[model samples]
Target: MFWVLLLLLAWAVAGAACTRLCLAAARAAAVGDTGAGIGSGRDLTLYEAAFLSGGPRRVADVTLVAMARQRRLLLAHTGWATVVDPRGRDEMERSVIGAIGPEGQSPIAPVRAAAATADAVRGIADRLVRAGLAVPDGAGTTIADAVRQVRLAVPVVAGLGAVALLMPAPAEMPRHLIAMWFALPLTLTLSCLAMARFEVHPYSRWASPAGQRLLGALPRHTDGAADDRTYLTCVAVRGIRAVGEPDLRAAFAHRERYLGQDDGR
Candidate 1:
């Protein structure tokens, strides 16, 4: 029957996607296993924490915020960044300055884009991966992308099933039977998504389970903290929205709207 062929196609799509996701998850778990005792009692640097919490772009955000706070860089509410101090205190700050260009002034958006992909950020990512605290590039389903694929598959299977039901079905086989056949793939996708939710919800795009544990152990700071270190730490782990200063937060908020960046969740 034509419906039978469609059902087979549905199963193929669901099986391939779900299998890939499961394999990725398994590989990620294996990485976690091998990372045992790594980074134990070792504190995360602001850059490391930024990468683990939100990847390279976040690292750029942290560096910009830190420099701006220290008055080494000027972040205008109009999304422009001006270099105040020619000398960078660290590699990260230097990267941002370089991204701002030889003129020492640039739009915050382009600078952020450039700085995020800079070698400094890559180095941080590499170190985190080596330490088993972050996922490697193209880690397949081990990253949040895999879960997203599975999520997409669910709706695809449902739509395909609906299409198949509208097609001609053998009288003896029955439309109900055809629908049941389609349900298998849908069920498979749903089951996988459910498992991922329960087992590894809010799947980190950057950190592995071992890394996540360390991140969880980091001290949480409230908005009232006066120390720049504590304040920057919160921004590093939590993002720009965590900035307590209205001027500082407004600066980032303006940048986000201009560049379509997230609120640093």
Candidate 2:
């Protein structure tokens, strides 16, 4: 039937898209695993951990949180960062301080953005990629794009099937047969999507499989001020909101909000 031809075309397109996406993801995962040396004695640094657990922004966040806790910088809940000490204790600290500029005070948002793009952060990312602890930028982008394509195609497939069933049928062509025919492709697409999610979702973001394993092995401290640095380290690797200090959490939240507005500009 004429309607059947249209439904077949839709099915072909959806099937091809799903197949391509799944194959690409599988290839990327395979390459990543080969590049990532299993049981290698290499240890993850704090900066690398931050990058793996989050990304460039997380590295900047860790640096800022460290300086704030050390009294080298002041992170106000008002969404501003102020310099308490002009001297930076390390390269990362120096980068953050430099991003804050000579005014000694600026909105935390811009500072975060600057720090994320700083040379120091790039160096860390470069080293991580070289060591195969982080995903290659291109590979990560490909995986993300593929995932998005599959997601968009799902609705298209469903719509096509619905339209095929609603179309006027000839006396000889049964609606039940049409429904069954459309269901085959729809089921195939859904199955492929589920498989891709199960296989790729874990390694879809910043860290490679090896890096994720290391992150899982990181310790979580429940003690008080004595482990404040450790706690902050956890926050950096996980997220700012994990920090229990209300004021500190507010500082990070304000920075995020300010950054969102600044980005819109």
Candidate 3:
């Protein structure tokens, strides 16, 4: 029984990790193939879909709402940010990132939260186009389509997670060894997601609030669209708006400085 308990714990952790890896793989696979001559935008769309996956239906929606809100935030800033923590609403108010707020609320309290990401997308696209760092119609629409698919895929991922948790552990080494069944496709998917996430711009959900703030994933900010100034380049792989050259070398330099100084990191 003790060994079984240990096995169960091991299974749970391993399963969860594998599941995350698998999900990521699926996303990467759908994102695009670098060697296939796919456009940057098409590649990104594949990535966007990979990111929309998550938990129970409601959880998935909340995650999406967060993503949408973040994208919107990039559009405009309303100041303070609000969140529904495990505590209550009272635990929400203070904007100091640690201040106090309304308390004693039920689980999953519905509240309005502003998005800082949407505005970011809009802002970067507009600026990058002006700076000539990008090429136009460069998969913008494709990226949007990918975002939609990713949002749709979220629930499916959540369901899969729950099921994986309940799945019985393999009984023998042979089962594990012969289990190349789901691995190949999964590996391929992951490779694709990696390609999409890095090679493509605008499609990287990791650039969004939903992906970053909630999912704890970090943006690369080191790929094709990685212009620091003009906010044209996102720390993600998604899209490329048309560019015309505005000479932003100094601005890019400053932006890089700010990123380095952020949180004193």
* Model 1 misplaced regions, further than 4 Å: 219-221, 253-265
User: What are the runs in model 2 whose C-alpha is more than 4 Å off?
Assistant: 5-9, 140-145, 220-226, 256-258, 261-265
Question: Which regions of candidate 3 fall more than 4 Å away from where they truly are?
Answer: 34-265
Candidate 1 lDDT over 45-130, as tens digits, reads 99999898888888999899889988989998767899999898888888899999899899887788788888999999888888
Number of backbone clashes in candidate 1 = 0
lDDT (Cα atoms) of all candidates against the true structure: 0.82, 0.75, 0.30
Clashes of 2: 0
Highest-TM-score candidate: 1
Error of 1 at 24 (Å): 1.0
Q: Residue by residue across 1-265, what tens digits does model 3's lDDT show?
A: 2323434443444344444544544444343332123332222221132222211121212232333233321111221224334322221111211221354221111221121123323343343323322222243233334534444344334433344435664565333432343343334434444554564433432223122222223232344454432122221221121122222112122322323432100
Q: Which candidate is the best by lDDT?
A: 1
TM-score between candidate 2 and the true structure: 0.85
RMSD of each: 2.3, 3.3, 17.1
> TM-score for each prediction?
0.90, 0.85, 0.24
Which model, 1 or 3, shows the larger lDDT?
Answer: 1
Of 1 and 3, which scores higher on TM-score?
A: 1
Model 1 local distance difference test score: 0.82
Summing lDDT over every window of 10 consecutive residues in candidate 2, give the lowest-scoring window: 256-265
